[model samples]
Target: MIPSSRNWQIKVAIAVLTLPVVFSPVSEAQVSQTLKAKESEAKQFMGLMNKAQQVYYAEKAGFTSSVSNLLVNVGFQNKPDTANYSYSIGMVNKAAVFNYGVSKQANLKSFVGGVFLVGNDTQTILCLNAAPGKIKPPNPTNTKGVLKCAAGTEKIAQYNYF
Candidate 1:
């Protein structure tokens, strides 16, 4: 009788521990909301990076690949990388470049932002991967003002200023 009672208690404990993993609409919705919140944070951070790059470019006549440079020279106050994402910047072209935020968490959206020098004006675009997978930053065209996202990605925002 004691052995049977102990086995029952162990089984109940296991079931309770696994309850969160069980398939349920409420859990699914909660996960979706959490993912969306993470994506929003990523986008907002990328946007801030974009603006800092723009300012750095104006003052230095070019963009810096170093986040510390942006922080010191452009007065960018936020951390370069976040808990959910790691960031990198590269010059895709002489007059166009991109910043990439790679997702560290599974199922989280990664982001990319492009800055293009179009004549006397600057055009910026932000894009995100259509699916949660390896994200590659788009190589923007230097000849045109527009920045086109690669396959499996979609544009989410754009900024144009003189």
Candidate 2:
């Protein structure tokens, strides 16, 4: 009876140890499936993000282009002496240009435009007499205006006006 009891205990131990080994392949398969699912979800999320980013930059570029075109039609020129007009448009255009630059570097869709800045002590509406698509090219085009840069000459930075 003692020998038989010892044999039974050994059998129980063997069974206990083998149980996990028997189920390990199934557990591994489940883990692999979970990893694959997560990878697929991440890919989908990245796709959506890319799409959103493209749309956002496209809209921003369009808006900036429209504003610049409007300003050109209304004769909004940059002042060489002062820094007001370029500063304002440059600030706004910088954000848009940065986004566009990132999108372009990421191999995403983007648009381009020209930014012009003009300042007057009192707001004045100047008109462009040129026909559509015949507008003058964007340059310093100060139109004899005063530009006020807070940091003076140290803040002359290159901007993506187009």
Candidate 3:
């Protein structure tokens, strides 16, 4: 009688623990929220990079060629976690080019993004060839833009999905 009661209690405990996983909308919503969070981070990181570039270009004629230098100058010991993207900056076409996206450890299968921000204080915008985010391209020819880091028909969708 004691063994049977113990087995029954164990089964009850298991069912109680598994009930949420078996029938819960919370997990699905959480996944969607996480994806949205990553996208938000990407946008915030772009703004941060733009600020850093502003400071760098003000002192120098051109943009910094290194991401580490820019981060250090901007007073970050490491990339902030508020964003889910890693950043790399360089000089392209005489423009400060900032690229930030998910790292390999963040996505195992594939990471489909590289948002290119090119411009100085006088002129800059997310490149036309870059992900437009449903907004029309400012420059279809992309010649008026001083910098570009994308090619072909690639488009960065919401959540940075291809």
**Who wins the lDDT comparison?**
1
lDDT of each model, Cα atoms only?
A: 0.78, 0.31, 0.47
Q: For residues 1-162, what per-residue lDDT tens digits would candidate 1 score against the true structure? A: 356988999999999888867857788999899999988988988887778778877878887777777767866666778788998888755677788888987688788888888886677888898878546655534345556777667888888754
Candidate 3 per-residue lDDT, tens place, 42-132, comes to 6556556656666666666556757677778889787543334444553445543444433323321112222222343433333322332
Candidate 2, which segments miss by more than 4 Å at Cα? Answer: 1-5, 62-162
Q: Tell me the tens digit of each residue's lDDT in model 2 across 1-162.
A: 356888999999999999999999999899777644543333333232223323434444322333233334435553311211111122244222111111111211111122223331111111111111212212222234432222111112223211
Given candidate 1, what's the lDDT at residue 66?
78
- Write the candidate numbers in order of decreasing TM-score: 1, 3, 2
Off by over 4 Å in 3: 1-22, 79-84, 105-121, 126-141, 145-162
Give the TM-score of each candidate. 0.79, 0.35, 0.52
Better candidate number, 1 or 3, judged by TM-score: 1
RMSD to true structure for each model, in Å:
3.9, 20.6, 8.3
User: For residue 93, what is the lDDT in candidate 2?
Assistant: 44
Backbone N/Cα/C clashes per model = 0, 7, 0
Off by over 4 Å in 1: 1-23, 140-143
